[model samples]
Target: MKVALLYNQKPDLPENTPKYQSDEFAEWDNPETIDAVANALRERCDVVKIDCNPAYLQQIITTLLEEKPDICFNITEGIGEPSREAQIPALLDMMRLRYTASDPATLCLALDKARTKEILSYYQIPTPHFRVIHSLSEGMVFLNEHHQFPLIVKPLHEGSSKGIFERSVVYSVEELSRQLREVIEQYKQPALVEQFLSGREFTVALIGNGETLEVLPIIELLFDHLPKDSRKIYSYEAKWLWDDPENPVEVFKCPAPISKELADEIASLCKRAFRALRCRDWARIDVRLNEHGKPFIIEINPLPGILPNPDEHSCFPLAARTAGIDFNALINRVLDEALKRYNLAI
Candidate 1:
């Protein structure tokens, strides 16, 4: 089979680059992920890379049509634009092409944090009680009706711990108001003020079709490694703080020591969430343990990261490894699952 792997790698950069520009994050675009997928598919199929750009999207489609690949293994993480993240998959669907990962509907729904939470809540999946506040006045409703203090606040449509900080977890009405104003004015996105869960945070990796979706080893984020003054939360800096010696980026422990009952609860709820979102292929489910020791579904990530290095602090890869599958084997499993869904003989 010939396969084209699509990624949302950034399209271009400024020419005549200066010395400071070389280290920019955009410089580390999509090749690494593309290369990882390419390496795995090289042995089983003819693989090609298609980096996406709306300006030259026609060229990508044209080339793929020419190649006539049997399928597409999408790994695109289009930088800068969130909406474009679903563009490649939607295009693949329009062409009636089989592709790996969740469908466009799931991708778009997961991209909007507020919508994801709403779906989870509708299904009676436990999560932090949250309200979407378009302005400071709306935040006052959370204060008056919910009567919840020490809530967490952040942009309603972003992930990867961006725009989250100690202040994001507020303890007082004054603090909530200030954070609400900052999120509204600066991010220009609606604010999500949620009741804080003081217990542990976990990410559960799930694979297979909805009928038999499998939950791999659950991973825990160790809060003890965080700085004394920092809140026991994962922030953008904690995710990308290179210079901080005490960063807990390396503190992930797989198959976290939660009781078997809680583990089963989390896994069952995760599968339900995957079904609720119409998640296809595979996904990762985030959860939190409330003070009562019950696990709550925080959110679902349809396009979970799968870097090759399990030790590099990637939850999906680590879970795959714990499930007794190597990185290449895991990638192949994803391909096989997608093919099966398309009724294509492997």
Candidate 2:
């Protein structure tokens, strides 16, 4: 089998870049992660690397045509635009090439938090009440009508905790306004102001498709491990800064110290979401409990991050490891699922 490993390598930011802009490449994979994925794919298949850099669009397209691999293991987060994550998948679609994970439309819809919530709501799935604030006036109007304290503000179109900080969980009108402005102005995107869920948070990883879909072990985020003064959120700082291979924070509990009933409920909820969104191959859904202990969909990541290092505390791999599927097996499993979907020999 031949596979093309498509990815966006994280670039170093220039000095003096604004704090808000520092996470521009946070969703992109680093050299270590890219190499890990390539090596894993190379273990079972002939692999070729294709950097999906927008600056070299023609070159990338030419390489894809020349290589003509049977399938692409896509992990490109893309650059700029609200539909960035969908760019590579859409290109693959145009070129009539098969790839792993969700289709372009699913990727685009998943990236837009508001739209994804709308779809979930349509399917009677529970998600926090949110308003997309395009400007300060819109946000102020929402605040006047809602007047809910402890709201979570985020960039409507970001993933991997980009544009999310500890201060994102606002407790007052003033804090909400500040975050709204920061996300709208600095991130250059509408702010998603959602009602905060104060209970425990969990991330669920699902692989395969339809009747054969398998939900990996659930992962609960232990916010108590965060700094004493910080809010309880898996913010950018918490995900990228405070937690590292060395001096790792004890922030995750796999198979989540929860009742079996609760675990089944979360698994069912994630499965419903995966089918509702028409996700193929695999995905990761984040869920958080409300004050009433009801699980609500936080966000859906059709293209979940797969950092190969066990010490990094990456949720998907951690969940897979707990299920007895090692990193290499997990990679090839996704490839097999995609191949089966395309009716191609693996």
lDDT of each: 0.78, 0.90
Question: Candidate 1: worst 10 consecutive residues by lDDT?
Answer: 19-28
lDDT of 2 by residue, 206-261 (tens): 99998999999999999887789988889988887777656766889998999999
Please report the TM-score between candidate 2 and the true structure: 0.95
Q: Give the clash count for each candidate.
A: 4, 0
Candidate 2 Cα RMSD (Å): 2.1
Error of 2 at 333 (Å): 0.2
Candidate with maximal lDDT = 2
Pairs in clash, predicted candidate 2: none
| Candidate 1 global lDDT | 0.78
* Deviation (Å) of 229 in candidate 2: 3.4
Give the per-residue lDDT of model 1 (tens digit) for 113-133: 888888888989877877888
Candidate with best TM-score: 2
Over 4 Å off in model 1, which ranges? 10-30, 79-82, 140-146, 242-249
